[model samples]
Target: MKKKYLIIGAGPTGLGAAHRLRELGADDLLVLERHGHAGGLSASFKDDKGFTWDIGGHVVFSHYEYFDALLDSLLGDERLEHQRESWVRSCSTWLPYPFQNNIRHLPPQARWECVEGLLPGNRPEAAPADFGQWIEGVFGTGIAKYFMNPYNFKVWATPLELMQFGWIGERVSVVDLRRVLRNIILERDDVSWGPNNTFKFPLHGGTGEIFRRLAARLDGFIEYGQEVAAIDASARTVTTKAGLTVEYETLLNTAPLDILASRWLADRDQTMVEAADRLTHNSVYVAGVGLDIQREAERNPRCWMYFPEQDSPFYRVTNFHNYSPNNVARPGRQLAFMCETSYSAHKPEKLDELMDQTIAGLVNTSLLDAARAADVLTRWETAVDYGYPVPCLERDGALKAIQPRLEALGIFSRGRFGGWKYEVGNMDHSVMQGVEWADRMISGTPETTYRWE
Candidate 1:
């Protein structure tokens, strides 16, 4: 006689939802994931050399105290806390991250060139109609020309002007003129200017370990690697890719609503299916490249590097090994690096070409020395996809209409692609969004993660 809940996707979001249900003393709740293992985009892998690598670039940073408490309880004192040492590789110089914060590294000639772009007339300040306008508005012509424009093109595979800026919260730093001038004059680093000045990682496993640990406490309550194919919401029954049908009293869907609506409600309700069609998604590729370098970043650990140059196929490169000693192969062996790129569905790319381009970028950016290319043991992984919500002008209007309709039907769709609000769509926001939704369901409280802020 207990109320039943059917949860989909065993990623962090789904795991959070399931954990909350157990805490609320709820029975008849089930969690299902399509991957053979959990973790979704945040999974990890080990190689023959006992080295670990994450699916994409993932870091643990939380804004809420409750989310922090949940992770502390789960991760315990063994968490590998990392001081975020991130930087931007602009042209031949390794500028301190948040490029605008530090410009002293550039030579006088380069400084003048950067200054040239900073003139008042060049500062784009017309309220930012798109992502391009947003970048120019925020950093001004100086940093945008040097980094934002070209780097964003490779990263998102779209014009910055065509994209929307609502999603760029802690992702990029907004410029400050007087502060930038002071930093360059003082010749100091301003890496801590962003929201995530410090982050945490698991001691043993990669980011994936957090979700795995959470699942362990939940008992054998998860159905792994099983995809949700269809749902008869009217009958309160759900069907899986393997043809298992289960009934539920209410449904918590964290999968892409388009997939949910198309496969489940397409035949049943034509409107739900059509509303989903308005959503847009961009594909993400994380390339794990193992290089044989004479001086491995191992000698000096740096958290990550950002690419704003066209030379690199990826817009971001996280020193996967630097996150933790466990992330790399045996130190005596060779070192490795990983890069990430987000692509549009309308613009697909071939892996071979991308790898070749990436290698070329390493040479141009001086990250990879061709002289030492012989010693480098290289491997490429395009294993994961799905990143960066493509925010066309119509995105906001479409989501506004679609979300309220679903909430009215006793369904809560939330997550990276679930609610599709990029402003607060990082790992911290995504997991907390799920937990808040679970709280709402348990106590009849309000949920902001689902509601557009």
Candidate 2:
């Protein structure tokens, strides 16, 4: 097969590129998806029991007008808007989402410790070199000890010192001594600190519905169940595991850049291979626990909660039923908890033991009662090999070395794992990366969302 453009992995990035390419009057493009279905990490599943769950905690919020317009065009009235009600589980109590800003909710002793650590002379004077030091320098010892350290470790499954602080842009709510004290004194919750304060959800399916509808419009442009096994960059050709080979003038790779460089690329050299080795990522296990809503207490308004302590094996759990009533078997009559636990070489977890551990964790963290364990209607779990693209100390350097070399061969890698940038790796950013890549390819528009430099 021959084509003008060939895209690997029909997730948001690939689909976005294909959709935009068609919109721009380019029809000679094809998207290859390994899975029979689309949506990639944003995908959702409906269990046999009729409960719907996303791969993890995914909320539809965007920073791009194009993404908003795309979502509006795709979902229309089939989506639900939601006010974010996020919280933190710490000190045997629930505090508002930004734990530092709501230190007043903590017991007096813990609250005092947090405030005391933020005092004028307590924090370090020098600029921090790594995420671990940055957490301490910015949040102080108390806040880091109580929330930032443990919660980040649980989420990233990487040693904080090995990671860089550059990715914390809007993802983390950075607070200072005055802001922390004022919020406590003013009795403010300070819940609205990030971009996802107000978000949208699909009314029927899970988060995947947005991508599903978008993919539907592309139709024949996408070929499912085709996993690219090898790529001859010099010849601009791709070979899939199913024994099909396609030659293209240009290629867009939405697969992991490390794999594309180390395992797939036929003419990769020592520099590309070494750079790929420096790129690291953690795996994630998502457990969807569902049950009949037996009591009024199960109908909480909070959307999700973070677990920073050892009581919960999961770092985060989303009240899936709250996102949309249709998520459960019975609308507004059942509960679905989508829990996420990340694991990596730095923080190894027994994948086999995680479900039981998660259930026990839910009970320990008070989301589930000990007696209701037997009443669980569904305990569905799925594990993804590439979860979060870690912003390691060597990440930027690795990308600088690898991306330019790939682009020189008429191959462009963009998306979450493809770009290997967690800072701009949200659904909106991922899609825009593809859209921008398409624009750059067809009209010579420069790419902005992702730049290796």
Candidate 3:
């Protein structure tokens, strides 16, 4: 069978394209998803013990009005708004999120180190060459050594020196030195920071419900359980794993660009192949721990916490039950936590021992009391192979070489990994990438987010 537009992967990007195409009066379009269901990495699952968990820690926060309108239309009353109460676990004390901004929470020696390093004329005047240098230049040795260094290593699974700056944007908060000193001098907390300061979640299902409902709106358009095996770009044809060959005038690929370049493209040049090979990504281990009883009062209010120290195997832990009551089967009778531990070739993890390590980490961090360790009701674990796209020093070069080459062949690769842009890879951006791509194809509107310019 053939179609005018063939979108691969029913994730946000593909769904966005599908929705926009329908609105633009395009009929000969189809979406092919590898999984039996849609949502891609944003999907959720319910464990036997009646606890729901997302692929990792995902929340609904948007940077676009269209995305807000689409979500509101889909999950209206099912959405639950949350006041993001995030914290960082450091030196046996809970420091507010954006660890650099709240130096007062640290011990006497640590606080002094951070403050002294931040004193005038301490940092270098020149621009930082890499993420490590950027951290040292912006935050000084104390915040870099104490939190940014270790925490970033855990999260990125790549050496800081190998990564470039400029992708941070609003993801990482810049410190206000005067405010930090004032807070330390006044004995106050500077807790509010970052884009996720306030977000939303599904009241009944996990984060997946939004995407599932989105997929439902375009029910007959998606063909599930069919992975794209290969794409003959020159011939404008795609062959799925199920042996279905579909031809299209334009192809919007939402799968990883590396996979597209190195695996799927039948006539890939060595330059494009090697450029794709340079792309790096980390894997995540999501562990869902369901407790027999509700969390203690203090813990109940804490939405999520970060772990930078080596005492914990997981980098971040989300108080899932605190996000929404429907996360657990029994509501007030049960509590849930979703822990994310990242790993890669740079930082390896013993998957066999991950569960035990995560459990021990929970107890070590005081997230779970030692006495109630046995009260753990569910231990569900899932591994996502493509967690975060690393912005290595070579990322821009690779994207420059790869994206243009694919686009030249009428293949628009856009999405989280598909576009290989972490800065605009959020849910809103990913969907808008698709939306803009459809607009580009239908009405000749120039693509914004995915364009190199």
Candidate 4:
């Protein structure tokens, strides 16, 4: 097959690029997807018991107007608006989300420690060199020791010192000293701090509906169940696992960069192997537990919750049923929770026991009552090999060398793992990466958001 543009992976990025090409009146493009369906990591699943679960806790939020308009055009009135009601489980207490602003929920002694460390006398002189240092410098020793360090470890599956902090951007909420003090004094909860404060969700078909709809518009352009087995950069061709060959003038890859380097480009460039070896990421275990019961009144309307303690294996759990009633077979009669746990070489896991551990975690963290554990209807578990692109100390240097070489070969790798940029790895960012890559190819527009440097 010969095409003007060939895209690998039918995720948000590929779909976004295909959508843009259609909008530009360009029809000579082919989108090849490994899986039968679209959405990649953004895809949602319905378990045997009829409960919907996102790959993880994926809430619909954005930082781009294009993404916003796209959502409006695609979802229309099917999008359900939500006011985020998230919380943190610590010391058997449910502190409001943004734990830094709600220290009043902590014990008096713990509260005092957090407040005293924020005092002027305890201020540090120099800037932070690593993530751990940044945490301590910004949140002080108490918050770092109590919450930030352990919670981050559970999420990132890497030591803080081994990771860089620049990728945090808007993902993390910086502590506001005055707001913290005032909230503590006035007994107020400051839960409104992140871009996801007000968000939206699909009213049906889970989050995957958004991408599936986008893919639907492309009609016969998408070739599903055709995995790219190899790529010959010199010939500008892609070979599928089915032995089909497709030729392209420009290639947009949304596949993981490490896989692309080692599998696709290894014979072409030996340097890609070394560059891929240095790129680090963690694997994730997403456990979706469906219960045969109504929503518990105590946790009603709760969107998601975080667990920082050792009693649970999961770092975060989303009340998936709260996001959309259609997620369950019978809206008010069933409930669902999706638990997320990450593991890497730095933090190995006993994969065989992860499902059991996740269930125990739900019980341990009070999301599921121990007495009602027997009422669990279905348990679905899936693993993603590339959960998060680790912001290791050497990541930027690796990307700096690897990206330009691929781009020189007429390949634009721009997506979550393709760009290997977690700061801009949300749904909006991933789609925009594809859209921008198309713009750059068509009109020589510079990719401002996902820069190679």
Which ten residues in a row are the worst by lDDT in model 4?
291-300
lDDT of 1 by residue, 1-453 (tens): 123887888877888888888888875788878878877767787765566778778899888897899999988986788888878887578887877777777767766666666666777667878888777766766677787787777776766666777767667777777777778788777777766778988877888888878888776778876788777666777788887787777778878867776666534366656656766777777776775446544344678888876666788888777676667666545566787876775556776677767767767877777776555565666635567666656567667666666666666688877777776677888887878888888898787765653
TM-score of every candidate relative to the true structure: 0.92, 0.99, 0.98, 0.97
lDDT of model 1 at residue 44?
80
RMSD of each: 2.5, 0.8, 1.2, 1.3
Per candidate, the number of residue pairs that clash is 5, 0, 0, 0
Whose TM-score is greatest here?
A: 2
Q: lDDT tens digits, residues 326-393, model 3?
A: 89989877878899999999999998899989999999998888888787889999988999999999
lDDT value, candidate 1, whole model: 0.73
| RMSD in Å for model 2 | 0.8
lDDT string, candidate 4, 1-453, tens digits: 899999999998899988988788788999999999999999988877888888998888998999999999999999799999999988788999999999999998888888887877675658889999999888888888778999999999999999999989888888878989999889998998999999999999899999989989998999999998999988889999988899999999999998887788634477777887889999999988887774456346789999888999999998888898999878877878889999988889998899889888888877778888888888899999999999988899888878888888888898999889999899998999899888877888988779868
Colliding pairs, model 1: 34-225, 131-163, 132-160, 132-161, 292-376
| Candidates ranked, most accurate by TM-score first | 2, 3, 4, 1
| Candidate number that wins on TM-score, 1 or 4 | 4
Off by over 4 Å in 2: none
Which regions in candidate 4 have their CA more than 4 angstroms from the true location? 294-299
At residue 226, candidate 4 shows an lDDT of: 96
CA-lDDT, candidates in order: 0.73, 0.93, 0.90, 0.88
Model 3: pairs clashing at backbone N, Cα or C within 3 Å: none
Better of 2 and 3 by lDDT: 2
